[model samples]
Target chain A: MTLTAKSITKNYKTRRRQVSVIYDGDITAKSGELTVISGRSGSGKTTLLSILGGLTKPSGGSVFYDENDIYSMSDDKLSRYRNAEIGFVPQGQGALSALTVFENLILPASLSGSKAKDRAEKLLERLGLSQLRDAYPRELSGGELRRLSVARALINSPSVIFADEPTNDLDDENSELVLQLLKEQAQGGAAVVIVSHEQAALKYADVTYRMDSGRLQREEK
Target chain B: MNINTLMLKNLIKRPLRTGVLVLTAALMTAAMFGGQAAAKSMRNGLDSLEQRLGADIIALPEEAQAKTDLENILLQGTPGYFYMNKQVADRIAAIDGVEKLSAQYFLVSANAECCTTKVQIIGFDEESDFTVKPWLKNTYSGRLGDNEILIGSELSTKVGSTLSLYGVECKTVGKLEETGTGLDTAVYATNETVQGLIKASQEKGIAVLSKHDPEEVISSVYIKVKDGFDINDVLSEINQTIDGVQAVRTKSMITGTADKLTVFSKGIGIVTIAACIISAVIMTAVFSALAGGRRREFAVLRTVGFSRKRLSSLVLSESFTVCLAGALLGLFLAGVAVFPFGRVIEKSTGLPYLSPDIGAAAGYAAFAAVAVILTGALSSAWAAYRLSHADTGSILREGD
Candidate 1:
């Protein structure tokens, strides 16, 4: 089933006052589609994605997938959904510094109780990361690290892959490689969500939306 | 494969820091276990001595006691307990309801080097000695021949297995079964043997030794009341009837002995508890620092769809693994540490000269280790929870 965020609202608290971040929004990404969310800094792209992924509680409204209000489920169920069904390539600090490249890439499968050895090796070879399998995150080039992050997000073979700026620090070659990989995941019947400000990523989106002023604006797809 | 194993590996990635923590915990455990062993042995020895002495009513000259007679004996050979003339034994025995009395002139022989231990010597006459004989019914099993004596089992095991008391060789043929009485480490002898030592000391010009005619000399006297007689009444009657005599009953000595042991045990207990506290604080501090240092990694786990609960499990599991390792290692090192000390204890205090009690040492270490592990786990758990809740926006930028 496709995921939809309908009028999801959120607030950020400071000592002075609580400020509304995501006022209200209706955004949907169907199966086998690449949905790109681009916005300027502080426009709440991450907050919007967090609500869609059930990573944080929204101040108001609800998120739905196949007509089920995800906010109504228990915290544990939400966590299991995140672990077994959704893949997230988090922004900064994506790599577990202590783990090797292979271990970091396979962490999601490990956490979800899935055997990931073959998948991990396959991903490493596919991403041109086989040579650096044993290297720590600190030893990798920026582009290599970003590719590892994408590999980690795909380890569990989730129905939905949410990547936040999967190619933020990569060169044109690595950037193109990462975008093509996400498009391939969408083409393979997985819903792909990309949160990035990188204009180079727009060419690969099946459907794209703009997050402006903490609101998702529909654009021609 | 589980979150626990993954977390443990991450926590122990810095092997040097983890090793240091485990070693500290082991040392703390050993100190705790060792100190407890020492005090336990001491108390066991004292209790045996109490049962062995067997004086129901102890008549000491009252005015000069600084501490209880038992404490005085434990510390300084009971000399602070004033020595009244032996005449009080007969007079107290003359009181109504007093069935028997015996006198024993005991000396804390500092200069007398007997085999391995220079200990207290009590001089008792053969007749009217109900106190020593009753305890001897069970403990004093060896034949009392010239230079033939029964050294305490603890003492017997030491110093060639036979004692040289007052320059006379006495074979310790048997050890008292576990009486748990205070006299477990004492040496017993006849009035003649002790008198001869006194005479020999006098010949050496130790004139400060309390003057007592070899015929009637004794340190303190023991009294037994007739059947159906009130012990308190006999005690007061002895006080009223006998001059220069203070008659104390069994209750006094029991309380006195228990109190002395409590004081010593508490001292050792304080030290053990302090070690536990220090270890816990150190473990917590080290773990907290480790957790803080790994905040980025934990945040990364959160982003990978590992829940806060999973993160917490990983952190606590790491702490548990360390505590278990430390406890087991501590036990091994403790066994090694106590080997020589155990022999000394078995020889001097006679608890038993066997292997260290694993159950006992583990029991003590468990008390401290569990608490410390929990403390460490709590710190790590808190840090992981906070990291999970931290704003992922900044970390995402950093990850990028």
Candidate 2:
């Protein structure tokens, strides 16, 4: 398993109330595989992905990458792991609104300590975003916005990619285009985790895991 | 994104907000710089006066109050006197520790027919004196002569015509350079000419001058100590030996009205500095408000995997850029304001001109800019640091 979660849990402490978002859970995604985490809204799908990507901490269990507990490392090390090892694509609009399309894609690559101008240009060309390179996030359509987010994530060239709702706001044609890109990454020997509640996403995922209250139960293969 | 590029992008994102913020920073910066510049002007003026009055000890009337009044012809007050016998100067010069000496011969020429305006006449031995000689940058008038009178440069503008000396008319011989003192507004003549005028004025019942040739007396002698001689010992000896003459040492002079002037100059500077500090606090508040309004943008940056450290660098970059612009602008404006006003201030008042120092204008400018930058940096850094600890999920949901 390239990325693994072993019984992770998280609780939100607030002035008004204490909310348990994610219960104990274990899920794994290996290189050259596609794992789809399917759940209803508020089923802790996004919460599980945040812990695996080292963005948010789990209250109980620890996440491991190639058998080393990711939580044991220092903040700087985890940040590097998130930057260079695991690529993250949040909501389609999580692409920075203030930055231009080219700037958004270049951010992840720059943080990873690579200044490859040629590669960024090629990525924009590959995603058909060359014409919209100077456009800001607010100017992008739903379909163009999703392509830009994917560009931002893939620009760092990480071994694993975690995408939350890659097809949430896309039309059917644009959704198929996004799913095809994910399938290509898995075929190219990268572990790809897609967090979605839509049943349409499962048709393309090689392995499907149903997240019920943060527990992963294999539903299809 | 790289630190510099990210900071540039963030500032350009909201041009209007950034422009207004920059203006606020510049105003505070100007106050800090301009106040310090005023203090520097005062320091420079005081130093100039100190250099001119290089006497080790000054001898005057027994009552210090009388001496002060006599000195008032330079605006001390009309002029009063308790005369020392003409022989007294020689007697003091012959003292054991006294090296060399000179005395003043003061004469008044108020409401004279030479010009519509009134003027004061102060006669010092031009041969052995250091007062006006050091400041004579350029002499466009007569050189120092025995019985010839020299006019102040500005005096010529009023009374360039000839004047009658004791019922004998003579041309205004020469003019002295601008010395930033009452001398600039007075006519300079020989000690003999002044005494001759004093004699005639007393006979005419214009002033209380001596009936005889005034005993050839000089008012207030300045004594310099021979090297390796204790100045305090000489002061004590003169006090004990001379019955009606008083000796004022260097230290006593710094505590006199001259010292009060120095204290007042510093007080002005302090009030100006306090005002600058208040403006800097206001600047900090302005920057904090800016960072707070941009919280959602910062959260989006966090999602893109920018670390808290990188976020801090971005804020500081903004601060440095704004400070640099504000400092340069403030310095340029202050230079424009101070140079002309300094002369006007000197001309309006009989008191000396004020200046903190030469390099201090720019130094104060930099100091103010750095203070503003550091304050903005601290507030922005703290706000962004807090942004990192925020719940990413909540921020995203709110944006949705």
lDDT of 1 by residue, B1-400 (tens): 4544675666467688879777766766666666666666555555554555565677777664622654445323323223566677767767888777788766555444663445666656666666554554344444465544444444545422566544555555444443333344556667777666666667756633555665565677777778899999989887777767677886576575567657766876897788777877788678778766776676667667666666677777777777767766876676566655654654453232233256765676576566556655664566666666665444554433
lDDT of each: 0.69, 0.69
| Predicted complex 2: CAPRI docking category | acceptable
- Expressed as tens digits, the lDDT of each residue in B278-354 for candidate 2 is 65566567667866676666655665666766666677778777666666676677667766586565544334544
Tens-place lDDT per residue, model 2, A1-221, is 48888878889888999888777787889988888999887778887877777777788898888977878987667667777777777754666666889888888777666885787898788778899989998888887888887777777777888888888778888788778888888888889999998988898888888987756787857
- Model 2: runs farther than 4 Å from truth? A126-128, A141-143, A212-216, B1-3, B24-28, B55-123, B127-130, B134-143, B146-280, B303-305, B345-351, B354-370, B388-394
Question: What's model 1's lDDT at B122?
Answer: 61
Each model's fraction of native contacts = 0.46, 0.28
Model 2 DockQ (Cα-based):
0.28
